[model samples]
Target: MTIRMIGRHIREGLKNMWRNGWMSFASVSAVAITLLILGAAMVVALNAEQLSTYVTGELEINVYLNQQVTDAQGQQVAREIDQLSGVKSVQYISKEEGFKRLKKMVGTQYASFMESVNSGNTLPVQLVVKAANPRETTKVAAEILSVPSVHNIQDGENVLGKLFSFLNAVRDVGLAFVIALIITAMFLISNTIRLAIFSRRREIEIMKLVGATNWFIRWPFVWEGILIGVLGAAIPFAIIAYGYQFLYHYSGGAFVALSFPLMKAGLVAHKIGGILFGIGIIIGLWGGIMSVRRFLRI
Candidate 1:
């Protein structure tokens, strides 16, 4: 299309919006609401995964040695653990060290009780294995238990397994919700455009009578719809970004640490912004096309 024709179509679309003020507002509002919900869902999904990852990273496999094992025998077991696949690091917690840690964790509640129990009898020297992936922890735990002196393994496999499963389920549900919102938004916008074009039947009829090409007539309406969608999305995008910025700066620390699949605020915004913008444009164009198709049929 020529620049002049394109300009004319844009002016007409804007004029249509003003002439059909309530309908235009409704269309933009619907698009805005849909995009906003989808955006929020995506942000939540990202953070959920991050939080899960953080927890996984923090996971430790505790290999408790038989209290009968000598210190030299325990050290040999620790060396074997360090060489195992997926093991990030190995820290040896002597029975004495374990007792001290127990004291800190229990605080004052068990301080007096701890004094009566012999440290060697109460706690066994342990090889704490940190894994690169939480799933690998089970394998590491099994391997540690195979060692002669390592009589028991106490990795929190049951808990991590349940947590990972829950995270996956939540992510799937969030995705479904976002997809549904997108579809609903698309339909709502399409109907609004249909109404907008329906109100301008005479103008389209006149153009059709003049033998104007299909592209010539259709392009403008599509562009107009796309522009409206873009405009609508821009407002909420800014609002969401600003809100995230505020939360990240102030109320975000606790949330950040706990995120399942965590990300910094800046990185999350950068990744999601382009996607939201593209979604806005696509939905707008779709609405415009649907609206114009009916007009062309007549």
Candidate 2:
């Protein structure tokens, strides 16, 4: 714990790397590979979380009026739905707007179908209602459906629920994968460091014989493990960051224009990077402690 003792342990650790060169290299290499795998998974998990949050924030409920309702009646229905509780705002799309959208979707061939569909039968006007919470969507949807001349309601809740479920599955898988890798890394790294320590067994026994405390022997190896993990994560983190940036520019903007904030790829990547670094340090420390414990027991 004193400066002189700390300095001595650090010097000993550095020298041991050369003294037991192959064994030391094995330990460092194991730490590097383990951190790399963990960092990659961390990046993916973070991005998935960000994307899921974005999707939840932008969820909306769609209210469709009855075809039997006249244009004026549909307008009245929209006005009433807009005044309902938990409705952030109501956007009304008249039958004409619906036809225009249908025209855009179906092209000239469907123009005849549109005329037929909208002629005597009212094209149920669409009411897009925003809710403060996704759960509020169902209640708000029920109220909208209760309005006179509002025949049916099709809120995107089913689709959004499925999406969130998928996202949760992704998160769970990522977490499990990361945890498994970290455990493996800890095992391998500890074994590698143990090998290094075993190579210096006689020297450690001599140190113990000479009154060197256990802490004196432990700190240096822990520092070495920390160093190896931090170094290993650097390159993989950089590569993942670049890949995220490229995807953001190439696909994210186009994807997000259609969906809400679900596709902010850049922010997602940034968040992932931060998480990777934290995991790397913890795994590195774990490798160090496990490695030293085996030797300390001797």
Candidate 3:
């Protein structure tokens, strides 16, 4: 289309909104409310996903070397574990350092007494192993156990298994819930826009009868739909961005003294905002085209 035609279509689209004032308000309101609900759900779901990641990241496997293994053998074992597919990193800690850590953890009151009786340090030299992902931890731990220098693995196998299952279940539920909401938003937004266009059936029919092509009949309404969607999303996007930032600060980065920390508001708010705007535009465009297709029979 020429620039003049594009400008005309835009001019007509804006004019249509005023011509159908009540219908336009209804369409805009419906889009705003639906996107608000969807945006709120997204916030909750994203935070849950972040929490799941944080908790799982804290889980690591501690590999204790056998007493017969030398310092050189321990280093070799660490290197071997680092070479494993699922392994993220491996750090070797000497028995002397481990003993110091024990002292520090046990507190100064008991440190002197423990030192007085400490003729020998029985703490084994160990490797601290981290998995690339929480789901891969079991495989990584199993591979670590295969090393001949490893005497034992302390990964809380049973607890870790249960934790993984629970986290996975929560993630699946969150994902399904978000998807359902999105589908509902699309349906409701389209239906609302459909109502707005249905009122203009006579205008559409006259245009068609006057030799206007389907594209020409549709462009004005499409622009109007896009505008409605963009306007509706503006408030919710702003609210979510500022609200999440306030919540993040009020909670001091984590949730009420909990170990799980939220994703940085500055980092994720703009990203979420962009996602919200994109989704709004897409849903608006879809509602526009679909309503035009069904109601105007174009």
Candidate 4:
């Protein structure tokens, strides 16, 4: 289309919106409410997924060596574990350091009890193994147990299994909910645009009766639909951005105590805002084309 043609289409679109003020308001309002629900759900689902990732990354396996293993042997075992397929890193912890950690954990009440353990450190040296992937921790732990001088492995297998299972379930449920909301939003927007078109059926027929092509008659309404979507999306995007920023500022390091750091507000807003705008534009354009096609029968 020429620039003049495109300019005319835009002017006509704006004129129609002004002429049909009540219907335009109704259409824009419907889109705004639908996008608001969608925006909220997206924020929640993204945050939950991030939290799951953070927790999974923290999971580690502890491989305890036999008490008789020398420092040289321990270093060799650490190197061997490091070369394993799923192992991300291996840190060798000596018995002395382990004893001190145990004492610190047990506190002053058990300090004397820990020191009286036969005047010699009974704790075995350990190789702290972090897996490249949390899901492969069990396999990595099993492989480490077969290594020479490795007496035992403590991978928190049971707790980690349950944690991962729960996280997976949460992710699936959140995805399902978001999909349902999107479908509902599309249905609502389509119906609203259809009603708006119905109100202007006569104008469309008059244009068709003239020498105007079907596309010429259709472009204005399509632009109107897109404008409604953009206006609708703008409100929710602003609201969500402001609300997230406020929450992040006032959260007071509470989430840090829970071991799941909240994502930065600016980053979240940028990602989520782009998604919202894209969704709005898609729904608007889709609803416009669908409604016009159904009504015009062209």
Cα lDDT, all candidates = 0.77, 0.69, 0.77, 0.78
TM-score of each: 0.86, 0.81, 0.63, 0.72
Whole-model lDDT, model 1: 0.77
Q: Which scores higher on TM-score, 1 or 3? A: 1
* Predicted candidate 3, C-alpha RMSD: 5.4
lDDT, residue 50, candidate 4: 74
Clash pairs, candidate 2, are: 66-151
What is residue 233's positional error in candidate 2, in angstroms? Answer: 3.0
Candidate 1 lDDT, 62-124, residue by residue in tens: 888888776678788788888888788999987777878888988888788877774335567
Q: Which of the two candidates, 2 or 3, achieves a greater lDDT against the reference? A: 3
Give the C-alpha miss distance for residue 36 in model 4, angstroms. Answer: 4.3
Please, what are the lDDT tens digits per residue for candidate 2 over residues 1-298?
Answer: 5789777766866665666667556555555565556656665555556656676577677777777676788778777877888888888888788877877899887788777767654567787888767667788888777777776777877877787788678767866776776777667657656766777788789988999878777777776666556655665677667866676677755445444333355665566566666666677778879879866684
Off by over 4 Å in 2: 1-8, 14-41, 108-122, 132-134, 252-270
Residues 89-130 of candidate 3: C-alpha lDDT, one tens digit per residue: 888898778888888889988977879756677777888898
Give me the runs in candidate 1 sitting further than 4 Å from their true place: 70-72, 83-88, 118-121, 132-135, 252-262
Q: What TM-score does candidate 1 get on C-alpha atoms? A: 0.86
Root-mean-square deviation of each candidate, in angstroms?
2.8, 3.4, 5.4, 4.3
lDDT of 4 by residue, 4-79 (tens): 9888987876776777777767666766776777777677666766766776788788888998987788888899
Worst 10 residues of 4 by lDDT: 252-261
Worst 10 residues of 3 by lDDT: 181-190
